[model samples]
Target: MDVTVNGQLTQVPFGLSVADLVRGRLPDPRSVAVAVNGAVVRAGDWERTQVGPGDAVEIVTARQGG
Candidate 1:
């Protein structure tokens, strides 16, 4: 299925969880924030939160800049 990630179109396998997505991209998934379909998903829930097709995923990493 197709989903939008950080405003880009991307294809992901079915039954993909938020954790899986994060792990695939970032070396430190815990240092980022994730939102799916406009709802912020808690870090603890990432492992169970499944991203469906057509869902908009916004992943932002925390930067240490003023």
Candidate 2:
């Protein structure tokens, strides 16, 4: 399936979950936020939330500085 991630087109396996995406990239999932198709998905639901084709996904990480 094809989905948009952070404004870029990307292909991912079918039935992919938000948790899988975060685990593949971020070393620490504790400080990350995810939204799908303009809706925010809670951390507890990441594993149950499945991403589909043409879905817009946005992932952000919290950082501390200045």
**Per-model C-alpha lDDT, please?**
0.95, 0.94
Best by lDDT: 1
Q: Clashes in each model (backbone N, CA, C under 3 Å)?
A: 0, 0
Per residue, candidate 1 scores C-alpha lDDT tens digits across 35-57 of: 99999999999999999999999
Candidate 1: list runs displaced more than 4 Å.
Answer: none
Residue 64 lDDT (model 2) = 100
| Model 2 ranges with Cα > 4 A deviation | none
lDDT tens digits, residues 1-66, model 2?
999999999999999999998898788899899999999999999999999999999999989999
- Candidate 1 Cα deviation (angstroms), residue 62: 0.6
